[model samples]
Target chain A: MAGFFCLLLVLPLFIQGFYASLLTMTFIYIIAAIGVNILTGFTGLVTVGHGGFFAIGAYTTALMGKYLGVSMLPGLFAGGITAGVVGFLLGIIFLRLSGAFLAIGTLGFAFAIGSILNNWSIFEGREGISLPHNSIAGLKFGDVGLYYFCAITMIFLILFANSLIKSSVGRAFTAVRDSERAAESSGINLRFYKTLSFTISAALTGMAGALFAHHTNYVSSETFGDSWLSVDFLVAVVVGGQASLAGSILGGAFVVLLPYYLSEYRDFAFILKGVVLILVLLFAPAGLSDLLGRLYRKILGKIVRGQSDVSCNLRD
Target chain B: MFAQQLMSGIATGSLYALTAVAIVLIFRNTRTINLAQGDFSMVGAFMALVFFQVLHLSLILAFVATLISVIVLAVLVELLVMRKIRNADWLTLFTATLGVYYILHGVSGWIWGRDTKSFPNIFSVTPVSIGGMLISEAHVINILIAGGIGLLLFLFFKYTRAGIAMRAITDDVEAAQLMGIPVKFVVTLTWAVGGFLAAFAGMLLAPIIYVSPGMMDTVLIKGYVGAVFGGLYSIPGAIVGSLMIGIAENIAGGYLGAQYKVTIAFVMIVLILAFRPRGLMGGQARREV
Candidate 1:
């Protein structure tokens, strides 16, 4: 684990330019996927419209930079806060809707955000918003610097999320997801936990969006506000392994790197993503994390006992 | 001007009604909100292009071919994708449909490219004077066809065993199974009918809005809003709600800005879901807890 962390820290040194940007994006997506997992995976509330929060975050950062000359750190926090507030309100409004209605309602939210962003002159419409230069405390980050920033933030967020998942609050979220009625009967306060989970998820995704804007140095409705952006986040969460923090890393890497690997047949990548999502849901409901865990256990067991005794599903 | 907007709104609403009905049909029975519903219609519109424009088939032949192909696609989706995870949780089912959505979207974009292609006009574009108000003949045909389809569906549901089975399943899955209603067959039939309606709506909408992979995005949202507005389980409510949405949006566009028109659907969803959780045409309210 120590060696893995070290290698991750120095990964940006080996890769430059395009590969560096890709890695940064992978980190950003992992952050967003973690947020998605908290809501969809842990909290049991699926949001097909997380792209709206992401847009809110990205735009918040971009617009703040453009008008207020706000630096990277402050802009990111502001973005997260703004998105969190929106998520809270939206959570309350959508509290009544569950199942298919909730999914469709969230989908509409993304579309609404997209159209609003598209036509709103403040967003600059199709032209988009560009930052002057993303800097923290007057220290501008180049590709390598940005990559390191994203990596550090991702690591920090992961640790924070891991702890969050282990806490009573996290337990409450899972309880709610497992059975809302049971949770309520047990005095879990479905309203409070659900709204709280949504707020945190939105904030985390917003922060990632802020990072994305800074990394790319641009924000536009075409890229950020598109409904596809929301879908991509959900893809990351599912592909990574819903409800698992480590899965977010795997899912994020998969989402970001798949297109790069399939650059030759770019369109094939989209179909492949859809196929993979369906296949994952059908066969591996636990996602890649479960597969990886099994593989690791099998290998470790073979090495330790000179036999394969892996009989049980670890998740169950 | 007001009358013209109203006429056009009804025409558009009629199409939305089709999509909403398709959505409600699938939702009511299977309890899966197929995100790929709109994409099925997209496939239909594109297939129509293939038969009519590419293969030089006659218009009537193309329409029939497109509907049949879409129905086949819908059934295949039900059997292959939906059936495997038939008893999964709502989140899992929703994600599966989303997967289908992406696959269809990617495949269509891959084949047709990103360009919006104009569909062959099924009705005359020239405005017809009715009571000193000008409305496109295409709009008139659209409304008529939508109404006719609604009537047919009403008859089928009211009389046919299969349709009755679908309603039974929607009401109670276990009870329907106990009654030996061939629940699986009815589910597949629902999907077929859903695909048919979606494709029909797409063909109707094709001439008005040029066909593209993403063309159904807004329509799907509005149709969903309409479905929710007219109780998710009620077919007639879906039709009525969609028609109202179409007219309301058109009026909003004409009086307010076009931007408001796009925003109205989202607002309506929140308002409807907030105020009347069961929708305008009342059905059993979905309670999560």
Candidate 2:
């Protein structure tokens, strides 16, 4: 029933322009959360710095558009590539520092990018860069055109992510998360896989950031603030459920919409986040998806039992 | 000019180190960061602000009152809140601390109304001359207070029986529990001490800088940077790490630019963690079981 409602609600998004932008943000957040999920959920690598790659993407697109006179296509790919290279370098060196150290290190990387973005004159020195719409492969997406473009892009990214997880490579990533000690004995190069995950995750995040900068038409250092990065993207996965792509999208939707609907009680917004997150930590740490999954199983079992009882009565 | 910049940075860094040390003390004792440290300090500063404004108490009396209030707040918070989660998972505990942060931010905003208050001038504004290089009174006092706090903590930890017991528990809580130490009680005491340190640092620094509710938000970031750099478990490391980052930031800001100042600590830590994951002084951190 809930799924039916979701489909109904999501249907307008396919037809309307505003709902498209909403899903555009959701898709972007999906990329960021998936990046973080691969590290935290799959590899047990904690990061508070996905925003750094995000900023790198936004900044790259803005810079290319402003200075290089390059179109948004190259700018978007450039954003992902830049973040991917940096993530690869960072992963190769810092992959071994688990838990708190890893969390802090990622934070440091984000802070570093923050400093550069704030200081760099080409990035407009904290005033922020306004992005122009792209002319993609001679097909320009202006105004309402974002609706179809973003929806299709999100579908493709989700499919790609799904395929990646289904491969043996995905299991290898999960193995590292579960137990690196055992994985080492099984010839899994933990360091290599960890780096691969970081790079792949950053690329996705970069793409999302580029889309965001292009969509909103603004890119600034504040967009990558530590608080938002730590709270919104990281918590979205937890709030939505981790290690699942559909859950990632759901998490993205919640993070964006929850704050929007509760904007009237502005202060209550974060207070509610704290409360809900605490509940998630305590009773439903596996996430909304996991909670719903459990309820579904129980209801299904009851239905099966009731049908069986009716059959017995008919047999008698 | 170089010496002056370096000195000022170290002075500020010392404060970060002091706060980081207190945070480390709490983490070591109870395996929690006590997200309320910033709040405890802010509350103390606010208390001092009130004592000075309303009752016209001497600065000395205000400090004493502030310290007492901070300790009391710490105890109440632990008794009412943290004790319930003694056996919680690290992530759950982490979320709990974040809850504390949100609550503190809310309460502080409610009380303070997001205004910056001018703290009394603890020192004269004139620069104190040293070999013709002018050092502001703020810089001098900041360094002296930070150093004094560091020394006082060292003495408290090294010379007292309760301090040794705290150390013992920090090293091995299960063993300390088995050895007849009231480990839970000691953990509470650790929180109290940590609170006192944060409040003291906040008060002393308040007079040097302006007092605002969100002031510690940035300070906390710097303090965490200092803590991580110094090795979260090492008191001396916190001090050394704070000073190191402070100096590096000063040099970086002086040469590289002030816009990049905030990144120095983070950039430093990332490089260091990549090369030295256990931190500069930390023993090998155990991999997750």
Candidate 3:
């Protein structure tokens, strides 16, 4: 584990600047994917409107930096808090809605946000808002600096998710997901946990948005107005392996890097993503991580264990 | 002015109502909302363009051809993709449809390019005077056709064995299967019908909204809102709900500026759902063990 941590720490040093920054963007998406995994994967609620919360986060950070000259840290925090509060309120309203209704409600939320941002003049419409240079303690954030910042944030957030999932709260979330009535009968407060899940998920995505704004130094309607962004977030969670932290990492990298590599054929890229998503869901319902895990076990078992044991494990 | 907006709203509402009905039909049979429902219409509109413009077919022939092609596409979607995981959890089913949505969007963009193109209007744009209000001929035709289709569907649902089997399956899938209803066949039929209706709406809307890959997106959302507004299971409810949405949007646009109309409509949906969680006409929630 120490060695793994050391590798994570030193790995970016060897990569080119462009790739490092790309990886940083991947980290930001991974953060959002983790947020999505918690809500949709663990809690069994589907949100196709997370883009609204992300936009809120991005807009908050951009506005803060533009007007108040707030640094990166406070902007991130405020962005998260604002999104979390809005999510909490939405969760309250959504308590009675479930299944398809909730999905519609969330989609409506996204559309409402999109329209507001696109039409409202204070947001500067499509022109977008540019941030002042974000720095902390007189240390300016170059590409490397931003990369380290996002990486460190992701590590801490992952650790937090790991602990949260292992704790009693996580179990309650799972119970709620598996059977809402059963969870309620077992003395779990459905309202609290569901809202809490939404709050945490929205806050995490919000922070990702904040990081995104700082990374790009701009926030605009074009970036956050589309419902497609929400689809992409959900895709990342499912593609990565729903309900698994490791899957979020893999899923985030896949979603971000797939488009990057396919930049030459932009339209084909979408078709390819659709094909990949359908293939994964059809062949590997648990997602790419489960497929990768099985592959890893099979290869490792062949190398380290007797053939008989490997065959026996494979049978199960 | 109010009368004119109401007439126009009803015309657009009729299109939304059709899409909503398609949605309801699929949901009743499959228990999964087809996210690609709108794109089916998008493809249909493009097919109409080909048959009418490229192939130089007569208007009626082109219309018939477009509907048939769309129905086939929906059947293929069911057979190839949805059939494999018909009983999967909601998320899996939803994601699968999302995949189809992307494929349809990408394919249409590739085939047609991204530029918006005009659709040939079946009805001339000459304004007709009714009760001192000027309304376009297309609007009148759209309203009449939608009403006729709605009446036909009502009759079909009330009298047909296949439609009865669909409702039975919606009530209880296992019981319907036990009763020897060909569940899979019925589901496929429902998809075909859904595709037909979606295409019909697309063709009707093409003249108003123009033909493009994304033309059906907003309509889909609004159609969905209409479905939920009337209770997703009820056909009449979808019609009434969609008309309400159409009028509401037009009124909002006329009174509160055109730019914020969509926002107002969405806010109204949220408010309605908040107060009436099951929708105005939705059935009571059954307790699941």
Q: What are the root-mean-square deviations of the candidates from the true structure over C-alphas?
A: 2.1, 4.4, 2.3
| Residue-by-residue lDDT tens digits, candidate 3, A90-198 | 9899888778788888888988889999898889878999998869877888888888899889988988998998899999999999999999999999999999999
All models, DockQ values? 0.67, 0.51, 0.66
Residue B114 of model 2 has an lDDT of 65
lDDT of 2 at B92: 50
lDDT of 1 by residue, A89-169 (tens): 998988876666676678888878888888889998789988978788989878888888888888888888989989999
In model 2, where do residues sit more than 4 Å from their true spots? A1-10, A13-16, A68-74, A134-144, A225-227, A306-316, B33-36, B39-51, B54-62, B72-82, B115-117, B130-133, B207-209, B284-289
Candidates in descending TM-score order: 3, 1, 2
Point to the candidate with the largest lDDT.
3
Second chain of candidate 2: TM-score? 0.93
Cα TM-score per model = 0.96, 0.89, 0.96
Candidate 2, after superposition: displacement of residue B64 in Å?
Answer: 3.9
List fnat, each candidate. Answer: 0.72, 0.47, 0.68
lDDT per residue, candidate 2, B97-133, as tens digits? 6666666666666666668888887777688887878
DockQ of 1: 0.67
Give the winner by DockQ: 1
Model 3 clashing residue pairs (backbone): none
TM-score, chain B only, every model? 0.97, 0.93, 0.96
